[model samples]
Target chain A: MRGRLRRGLLLLVLVGYAAIVVLAAWRHEIRPGWLDAPGAVARGLLAWAGIPPGVAVFTADSASAAEAKIVDLCLEVRVVEADGRVVRLHPDAGERCPAPQPRIWVKGEEIWLDRSAVSLRAAVAARRQELRRGQSARATRLLAEALAAHFRARAHAEGLAPERYALLWAESRVDTNTGERSERDVALMRWGPVGEGDLRVSWRPDASLLESHWPALETP
Target chain B: MSDGSSSYTGQGVLERWLLGPVSLQVMVLNRIVLGGVLFLHAASRAFELPRLYGEAGATWSPAYRAWVDAVLAPDLAAPLLALVAALAELSPEMREVVVIGLYTVLLGSSLAFASGLFTRGAGVVAVVLHMLFVTIHPFAHYGWASLVSPLVLYVVLSRAGDHLSIDAWRRRRRGLAPLPAEAPAWPMRLLQIHIAAMYFHTGFARIDDPLWLEGQALFEALARTLFTRFTFELHVWSPLLVLLTWAVFLLEPLAAIFLWVPRLRTLCALALIAMHVVLEILTNVGWWNFIMIAGLLAFLPPPWVARALPGPVPASR
Candidate 1:
């Protein structure tokens, strides 16, 4: 009887362990994805609180431009890849920004970028080409708002639709025809690979007229 | 050399109790398995499920960057370390190299310790090995690895391997008698307790995560599969998964204690192994879960597998 009891207790315990392992098979999905909902909330909160990803511009004239047209070129841009790999701009985004890379790296392969790291000029130029290429009123306005944000905090203004468009543009590439944004969120979750962390960019100002644009990535 | 003779004194007393047929079987079986699992996990990395994983990892994975940093510096230290781990695990063309060279060396060392041959030397090797190959694979590591680290250190430090191992086999072969002394009852205790911590820690840690609570973690994993997208095809599994998730959380620690008693440990070990097999089918967590189960299987009481083998009387008998 004692032996039987021991066996019975043992059987119970084994059954319990079996139950746990079988259930744990799905443990990774039982919770909200790490940083999924929270990361979005953090960005939104920062925006509402008027806290951006902390951009700074160098002032030559040394004037406080509340409306000082500033195009803080990203000196160092970090792009967070879908699989969590980060592609970084080499040579710093300063004097010579090494060409953009496709935020991807393979183990045995030589490392190269997919595209030259996107510069502020590139981002703006991309925006311009996108705007001209796309010809949607919505597209134009989004590009314009992004341009305005580069100028000064006070000068930055947006139409509701355009602001949404700007956010979309920041998120993914815009389609030329349907005006639809790429499903980057879906892409991220689908391929949502994360390893590389943080991409950096340097913004270069367009011209002297926009010299108030002090369009340079300077850290304060 | 001393003449080999049984130190077991009381003929009737030994005959009546542990020196009987059953007890001897347990000792031998335990020795073989513990050695085998250690060697196999390290040796199999070159091919099979784990190889596919290594290839996928070698792909432009964004997720493995941190792991890459840990294992793959361009320099020798990191790369060599990774290579050693890899060669031990994968080298398919050299399967024999790993299986025989590496596995035999380590298992032989473990056997020496177990059989009281060179107890301290074998203990040191075991501790060094478990530390090097076990804990640092953060991406692939799970709760069980850390739990066993200290216990293994203790086993080596205190000389548990001095008992029923190849060391004993050699001693008997060298005209020395088999050891009447036994492996401490405590390694059984240590394993049981350690596993309890492992299950409880994992189960509890996962409880707060929204994925575990909602049972979405598994669904999400399933969603990733080409055959079954969790959204449509895998959704059928969603309803039942929540209850199943909760059940797993409760059972893991309980299974650890089951090791103390004989019958229960066997069933539990089987259950754990089966669970790993099923998980292996469902997800691509690599070989971590399998290796962990293999390690835990070492703790199974000896008599169960030995029943199949020809064996002599039990130790106490």
Candidate 2:
């Protein structure tokens, strides 16, 4: 009789538990709004536990603009200024900025951005396809380098002396799932006086960035 | 003690079907493995506490906040929101230090639970800490964590420290006889149902997607080399990829049901384990595959565990 009682109670609890799991799955797949009640209960528990609530939401079009938002990652940037004023420039409307994401590292002079989201083949294919179709004449280019060049061209169009401002290469990516903006410095190149300069760009390896960020990454 | 009905007749057929004798060893083994998984899970995230949870961390997602505000009562959301707001006042260095400190506490609690030292208290604290950590960041939490959260809750309700643990060893040293090796059937039953339900829901969910139906889901997933162990340039193998995709889709619901059958249970368990292993190798799902593998271990009968250990099995009380 006792054994039967134990089994009965265990069965009861297990069924109750299973009901909750199945109901949750159903809610998640079918009636997601139903979860709000439980979520509210949980939040109340968390509130009772003394966790603060607030969302981290911000926008960044340039590396300097992302400085205050750099949380757990280290970003290195060399901003170029003319006459103590930042050569502020924005991307053309609807174009993704070339600013790097929050996670980046500096190796000597070159900054390597973590491009985990983009494949080299895809980037190369997009670039080739754009050029092949003569779509480069369009207002937008999907290639990062091409987008950076457009921004640099914009800076020149603003009448800033080329030699007076260092070229800031912002590596930016909007997270596809969340639409969150993350931008940082990829590479910065110094130029000579306007109309008398040869372009030389520095390239860094993906693994090299790991070495620079390892120390800070140890705790974060 | 009777609630006005005989124990046999009062319980419905469904109740009798659900309740049965299960090997205690299965529950104990699950407790140990699940605890270890939880420890490792917490440890891995400890390294990213600041970016995941602190003020200086990634943007506090608006979507995450809105969901919390809308679903949660204001009283509950207020304190949580207040805590998040308070982080802004801390200096960056101080914030990092505090985040590190919190992660350390979580890790230590997890370790204690895994080792079965003060199992109930430590396990309870660990579960609470884990739930809090889950709430801290939208990105930091994942499906595997959510799945394990309930098991951890069950762990606290269990006499999981009765065997294969520091608590058990100490009890033996103090002249107490060890608990009978066989555990009540409910824990394993709960786990079995949980796994089946997961597969059932997910399997059904995938069938509705055109990608799975058309057989391009696995192939498209494999094309992204980031998650896979290797890349194949085999354009000719599209048919095989589709077959593999259908196999997964069919196997899930089948396994969920057949896992309860005596004749088919072992086969289903083995196949499910293989699926998880193949998925693990083919994808970069982190601890998810490991968690599933551990959960699957409950399918092993208690006799297997008892035969391997040195102690003679105590007669069922």
Candidate 3:
């Protein structure tokens, strides 16, 4: 092909791509819409060709939406031991401890204490209710205090008191329909055991803080 | 007697600029690299076919439907979802078998593409299977995957297999000896344009974000040590983190434009590679950082590539 012809064709294709980007951005929001269509086209072609459907491909928007759904439903809780043998706070029966621990972590002098799974569930539920009520900041504070108490109680039960420990919170969501999983760090809180019913602590909800983690509860 | 050829001065500016002959070495390299990357990508998922794509997989009919409804237009979604629903009706065992078969085709075709054997046919099959994989699971999609999709399609239409390939070697063996080192530049140029647009858009999007503006994005990113390969304590390096943030903002747009400048092209490529390397080190973004760097390789001049890596050097036009 002549260079001029090729360049003209190239120009046409780029303009078309640009148009797609503009349309996608205008309709959906900021994401590059041009990128979304190929997978959709491929899936549509398969369906048209009567081929069996295959694995899923995510667009930015769809993945984010699915992520939001999962976050509302799943929480990943772990307790780190002093010797560095972390335990899964809620492991299904017959499930082995994952070879790799969750990326969500807390720094500073650390200790692990095991507590009642049932109590943690109740506390998480209470926090969820507060979140649904649009009291995200307050709920995060409460959750932090509850986690600190849970650790202190465990220390008391074991007849050992650690000078300090940190709580790592990671949230995960699984799609009910497809079993797709999405997870993110929720928060990390540092707490030091003090006198009875007293604790010194520093807590923050991820880096974006409570607003991003509890987007649903953000003030309109 | 009038000669057929016209004088160079008589040619229009567009003709002069767009019609200039360039080497196809970069295009051929791009073809091989993409084919290899995609083959490994497909092969890696072969064993997990049943769990990730079969009817019994997490992204079954309902999940596929939700995804289509969310991203695709109604006209496109209806047919696609119906097709998914039909496919989802297959028995678990049958779906598993189909998934395995599809991946096998993808692996073979991708290898063929990389080797430049049956180039056109292999390219077609590879692209088709790649798209199916994308449709299989909503959660599996990444930006790099989409970028590769168009690129593979475009290269399929070019003379990407003309050299540095099994096809070339076979032709030489068959008496079409010493294939020309330079092919047309249209395909590689198109790829360059696409890459520039991507960089521009990415940088443009970040221009307004408070986190990016305040140079706190990296600080926030640093705190998420779960994504890092090794522990990196950066509390005392806050100022440097802030400097790196602004550097990213400057480098992206600079790379996008200066990449076309022959004098600055090499530097731009290096800068982009460095940026991606940092991202790879600091975060678990999967194949994204790698693919983006690979995509940028399309911008490299053939002579530079020939000198830098082992391959057939470009022939003068």
Candidate 4:
């Protein structure tokens, strides 16, 4: 009787664990409403324990939509000296700004980005959604200010005096519908006379102010 | 209650398969490979902790904080938010120092875990620290990093250090006989189940998607500048990309099942490894392919692993 009880308990535990795994997998794939409570429990337990509950990998849904929509995103930064000289930060040859680059020195040759930059892009995009109605100018100014602050911090970390020069940050979105591939720059933020004081942002500045240095995408 | 008969014969078939004695070699391989992968991942981010997690960085935004709170459970999110709030009170220099200090401990513990010296303790520390860092700025992580914690936890729960470890070596030096090569197979079995579930979910989730079904998923992914390694005229190579996409579509769900069959295990493992290798070459996903390859090592036959690895011969079953 003792042996039988022990075996029964072991079987019960195994079955319980298996059920959890299967449930987690089912919730991840199917996402049925009835499973929400159990799924939440499973996700909470997994997150608390730092265990992966096994989710779907990349399905390229968003990327596919981006391609089909012909949307192009490029981030540009320019440093404007007090003497009226503007210096653009160029990405390495054969690479685009804001995309991850391979850091060969790291073990396993991992690809890396500032990551904070990517986060900033996401934050800007989310903020854009809220400011979409009539607050476009305000949204543009906010994006520019955020970009300027992030870049300033990066400069400080690299031992550069960010206050010594004004920073110009802008984003260019290509109008692929025009057939001629005309690009327009939305000058987000212009922080000048580099200082710790409140930044004066000018939104919807002249598009010609910031020259696009990014290479044009070749049509297939 | 002691019987002269072999104890293995008394158990049911399911019990025998799940709880039966198996060589500890597979577990040891898992511990080492997973540990090494963790170490490499941590080491790659060593210089960027300040920028990635500091107050002045992009992660400090109010929007991101709200996003984190929404994604994590309330119980888990509260402490993480509290910790971030506490860190917010620190000076910039001090915050950088604290972040670097935590990262150093994580890196060291990962090395120790991989080396199998104080394996369980080191593994726990590594997993906790990794999870903390991942939670703080999850945008920096990918699917590969998500898989690390559970895999390491499985390793820690097993008797992975029973053999082929510094602890085992020290025991032998103290005149203790080396442990038997065989141990309960449940932990490894659980790991196998986890991998299968992962494949099953990823595979079936794409089944009805028009992009994947029409073989345009890979093409679209490659066309995106963010993920692809090079700029090329992909339209010319669309046919080849479609073939690869279909290959993944078929093999993924099939491998999830065949991986359980003794005769088909090696074939599935090899096919999966080949797919990962191809992905590594075509894209710049960080450490994902390598981590998957490390997990695939568990599915390899014990005798094959024992022969390839340099160690005392595992006793025959």
Candidate 5:
């Protein structure tokens, strides 16, 4: 009787675990609209247990979405010193300030700053889309502030003392059919005085400050 | 009792198939490969730990803070916030020390797990630490957290350290006999089923999408500047791209089914491996193709694995 009970319990546990795995795959990968409520509950439970269910739809990018347009976003930073001297920080300015590279020999080989830049650009683009749909622009502003804080932390790490830092968000668009490319500086975000968290965002940034890095930004 | 064939029916067959004794060699191989891959993945991120997770990073960014506030339940958020508050209370230097210390321990655990030193304990610690990091910054590491976490958990549950491990070697050195080279088959069965489910879902989910159905998905992926490793004038090779896309469309779902067939198992596994290899060459997906290939190795017959491995052969069931 004891042996039978033990086997029964083990079988029950195995069945329960299998059910959970199957349900997770169904909820996350299959993602049926009717199962949204159950999916959310499952996600909540998993998150509560500190297990991320992972990304839904692996390698499932929409080709239509990719073909729609190509947008390349870049970040440009300038440091203002207390003595009225301005120092421009290049994205490729050595190990201290690294930016995302278009081509890498292997995936996941980029440094932390480059990865962070990729995340920031993606977040900004998502927030911008939501803003265009009449949603609140708070998220976009929050992302800008996050970028400011990141650069501030990076500057501090590099032992740079600056009165203020100006951040410019630039965009490069490629006409796929005609093979023509254009570039413009879109917005600016500022963070100041080296140790504080004050951030300001402006939609109209100085276009003249946008460097002629079009060839560098080309897709090929 | 004249013939055991009478016993192989209904639930008994399934019970025997799943819970029956099997060589632990495959599990041991899986544990080593999975653990090593995980270690490398973690080590790859080690260089930028301070910049990514420390006082100098977005770990405390307002967006992350807001996400924690909105996404996590109050019960879950409170303790996490309290811990963060405690960390914040530390001096900048002290905080960095704490962050680096935890990261170092995480790396150590992954290495220990791979080396099969205190296998279960190390595996558990590795999974927990990896999950903690993933929970804190889900955006930074993509796909890998979800794919590897459960596999590690399964490895921890299995008796993978029964052979080819330091634990086993130490037992012999201590004048004790080695444990049996076989364990219950449930863990391997679980891995196979889970992988099949993944392929089934991913493949079938694309059925409704016109891009995939029309064979333009690969074309679009290759043309995209964000994902593709290099630019190709995709129009020139549109026909080949479409053929490959259809091949993937059919192979994925079919493999999910045919992998279970004894005669076709090796063929299915090889085809899937080839697909992953092609994907790795064409795209910038990190460790995904490699992880899938590692999982696919489980589908190869135990006899084949035993043949490939060196040393004295264990008797088959």
Candidate 6:
């Protein structure tokens, strides 16, 4: 082929590639989005006409509405406990808590905040009994705001970039039988051992081989 | 970038790079460049003090290590034992001599691979040692992390030393052949395929992640070194940079396709090269990516490289 024609052909292929990405983006998709389809195309092309390389990678999308709902629930809890008596219970907070030792994603140090950490839970329930507890209502609003910020901050610090992380966090539904010591499934970067009492940490949730080693907790 | 044929009025830049249809010499350079990459990589494993003890210890692992050794026993043993020839071969010799002697054999094996001298022997030795080391630390890293051995091991088997090595020198003295006169092309193409797999799989695995989707992947990557690059310790996000991130994100697989397409092969070569250049500036991917990107030039027509070779060896020679 002539040099000019080859260049033009090259231009056409590049333009075609850019056009496909643009179209995919417009159609609510992008590279690694419609991964299966192009993979199929590439695979078929290769199988029938021989591919240079045989390996390929795959991907999928996940939802975040469930997480947002949970965050909303936490906010509700904050509202339910506002203006209650000072539960000045334990400033000992986490000083006596066991050291967190997650089994996975150990890039740096990590700590966990349990549901029981809410030293004010039962106290608020008692004060919330009165019909016109005006001061307690305001306390509820403050609690809601703090909890919301805590979850968001946790998500961000875990190296989760907003959207997917928030959704996945909510996906990890926190559950308990008698509420004695309920656990929250937390996957984050840490630098040490995660004991049985500490938070659960698993990075590649999809890889069963790995996840099984550091099994993530979940509620049915 | 459009300078493919845009008139070189003075210095002859085009003549130096676009060597018209792929040539035999281009193929040799392709193999040599590939050799440099293989040698450098193997050199690390060979030189690493920590890995030596670690892999040597694994040879005694009661678990799967023994099984792997049983299968490739001979291939897995000789050079590895040679690596441990650390025992003073000559007691009369100085400790520095021992160090230098071990290093000489190690370096010679690497150079043999790099220069394609007795490459099959060198390459085999390289793989055997690599297998032994990795088998021990299979927990420390994954097989994907050591992806190059199988690819260059292909070169060693193809008798790459026949053209570009001291082995080739020995061959020349024996009066067998003038190195076939035409370069074999499939091995390079095979290599290009291998690298494309690495990039595609890497990108594919991270596709669903929010950072890659929002184009913050590159930003986070830049952020690792962001605190130092600027005078002000700044964190500014630009819409334009994000758009560029998306552009490159979509380009890797596209470049792979272009490299395969014969008509646009040169264009693809340049695009991929530029991609690596940008990657080099933005990340610390090491010579792995850069060398692979440069080596992708093989897909271009030989004439492209034909135009690229020097007019003469230069009278200084």
Task: Please give each candidate's TM-score.
Answer: 0.40, 0.61, 0.61, 0.64, 0.64, 0.46
Considering only chain B, report the TM-score of model 2: 0.80
For DockQ, candidate 1 versus 2, the one ahead is 2
List-wise, what DockQ does each model earn? Answer: 0.02, 0.13, 0.05, 0.06, 0.06, 0.03
Q: Model 2 — interface RMS deviation?
A: 13.1
lDDT of 4 by residue, B10-50 (tens): 44656766776777777788888888888988888767866
Evaluate model 3 with DockQ and give the value.
Answer: 0.05
lDDT of each: 0.38, 0.54, 0.58, 0.60, 0.60, 0.40
Question: What class would a CAPRI assessor give candidate 4's docking?
Answer: incorrect
Candidate 4 backbone collisions, by pair: none
Interface RMSD of each: 20.8, 13.1, 12.8, 16.1, 15.6, 20.3
* Docking quality (DockQ) of candidate 2: 0.13
lDDT of 6 by residue, A64-154 (tens): 2111111111111111112322111122223122223211110111112333443333223322322122332223223322233333333
Q: Which stretches of candidate 4 lie over 4 Å from their true place?
A: A1-7, A27-220, B1-11, B70-94, B313-317
Q: Candidate 3 lDDT, tens digit per residue, B1-317?
A: 01235334443333334344666666677778788878988888777766677654546655444444433323233343454555666776776777678788999999999899988889988977776666555346555765687678768877878777889889988997776666545565567777777777666656655556777556555543223444334445768989998999888867768988989987898899899998888776556786677668766655666665466656443
lDDT (Cα, tens digit) per residue for candidate 1, span B1-317:
01124324343232223212223233334333443434454445435323223333321132232223322221112322343444434454464344345444665665554454566676567545643444223324333444444444435533344345556567778998665444433333334444555655465555554555555445444443321211233334657766666556555656646655666877777766676676666665544465456446545555543444554434441
lDDT of 6 by residue, B1-317 (tens): 23645546322233223322223444455446655654565466555543333323322233223222222222222333323333322242353455445444655665667676777787676555554444433333333325656565646645356554677678879987655534334344445555555555554544554545676445444433211122111124446557766877777656646656778777767777777777666565445564565456556665565555442211110
Error of 5 at A128 (Å): 17
Off by over 4 Å in 6: A1-220, B1-27, B41-106, B135-145, B173-177, B225-234, B237-240, B306-317
Model 1 reproduced share of reference interface contacts = 0.00
Ranking by lDDT: 5, 4, 3, 2, 6, 1
Stretch of 10 with least lDDT, candidate 2 chain A:
A65-74
The most accurate candidate by DockQ is: 2
Which of the numbered candidates is closest to the native, going by highest lDDT?
5
Q: What does candidate 5's lDDT look like per residue over B1-317, in tens digits?
A: 11366446654566677777888766777788888877887899877787667867756554344334333322132333445545555777897898788778788988888878899999988877776666555546656566787788777878987677778778889999888877888888788878887887677656555556778567656643334675544556879999998999999888878989999989999999999999889997677887788778788877777775554336354
lDDT per residue as tens, model 2, B39-158: 888777655655567554543444334334322323233443556556545776786677667677778777878777888888887776676566555334545766777777666666
Could you tell me how far off, in angstroms, the CA of residue A22 lies in candidate 6 after the best superposition? Answer: 26
